[model samples]
Target chain A: MAEQVTRKPYVREVPRMLWFLRHPRYMRYMAREFSCLFIGAYTLMLVVGLKRLAEGPDAWAGFLAALGSPGAIVFHLFALAFSAYHSITWFRLTPKAMPVQIGDTFVADRVISGAHYAGWALVSLVVLWLAGAF
Target chain B: MATSNKPIVWGPFAAGGTLTAFLTPVLILLTLLAGLGHAPDLLAYDALRAFAAHGIVKLGLVVVIFLSLWSAAHRLRITCYDLGLRADTLVATLVYAVAIAGTVAAAAYLLRLNPV
Candidate 1:
């Protein structure tokens, strides 16, 4: 009888990877998460302002002073960039989150995003007016 | 391995739901305290501080903070996975572990702060 040849189990050097990030679904998800960075930072900024409010008048003034500093101004500009990205992505997602159908007629996603942009524009005008910047 | 058609459920929702169920009452209590609008007169400090001092309140906050953080971390991991970022099981586990730990530390620090 011929000797039976031993067979070794095959092991892949690189494991079978799930390519989720490359998927379009993942690209959208990542964009949303990146937007949260702005939201988190904005929240912290407000919290710091609130803490200063609780501290006293001097602290509050100091907080306002810090906000006007060159570093703070740069951070605010960066925050604005993130905020814009966040706003666009968030509004774009609104249609998915709350689909609107009027008697079997589905509303367009562009309509939703456009409505949000209009609303923000109105809000900005109102805020600028209130701040006497207009 | 064959994949199932059923949607994969995460653990944080189950844990967070249980935690939130218990925390809701405390949140209501805190809301009521804050609503009173005389925290200084009633508690000599901020309403949040007053609420933190109570045993049940503290426990409720701890539960809320940790569970919420865990839930956020789990969601963040899923988001990262969806984005085609690092989606290894080890990384996901580490993300949640760190989030839970950070939340616990934050709760502890908040509890230790003396109300003024």
Candidate 2:
């Protein structure tokens, strides 16, 4: 451990919002991380749906009606696009954060990332099938 | 040095991140479909209610909702910190509280959903 000094030390502050602007990767990472807000918002909306359902059909119907509004539709469109970006970046990053090893050989990052997309497709298909969207 | 119990929250945050990555886009599209009035018959009020009325489905919803909420909470907290919010304790409490409350509300509502 270094000895503590009584002399004043120089310090520099990073511009919080624009800090990531310095690097393309940081910018992309920030954008990816920022997608969580939209995800959270959508989840809250789902919770609202659940609440409406629990309140009975009239409430649920009202919720559905609200969902049909132009504003809601537009928001959903943007949120969907933004969320897709978030999802893609997230999948790419997943392999880095959570790595896999098999029989003394580490799996390739792209393969792990591909697995994320594959799983997403699989789950979405099941959900769509069960929901009778097909 | 003071100890920080961030690891506790980080665990769920990480799990939630993974779950959110997989489900968020699908959910967004589904919501859009519903909003556009092209919702499948199975997703209509009566059918959707019946689908959600299953105990297993409700259980899964609870888990997904809980994890996703926590994940979002932790993410937002970090974002806030990065964005120059110096109140770590306050931000953590508020964001995490929202996540926890949302999870509790989801579980409660899910439990109230009667089986058809």
Best by lDDT: 2
Best by TM-score: 2
Candidates' lDDT values, in order? 0.52, 0.84
Distance from true position, residue B76, model 1, in Å?
4.5
CAPRI-wise, candidate 2 is medium
**What are the TM-scores, per candidate, against the unseen true structure?**
0.48, 0.89
lDDT of 1 by residue, B25-83 (tens): 23322222323332223223344345455667556545656654555456556666554
Q: Please give, for residues B46-113, the per-residue lDDT of candidate 2 as tens digits.
A: 88888889989899898889888899888888988877887999998999999989989998998888
Model 1 clash tally, residue pairs: 3
lDDT of 1 by residue, A66-102 (tens): 6656766566556555545545665666678678899
lDDT, residue A132, candidate 2: 75
Off by over 4 Å in 2: A1-13, B1-4
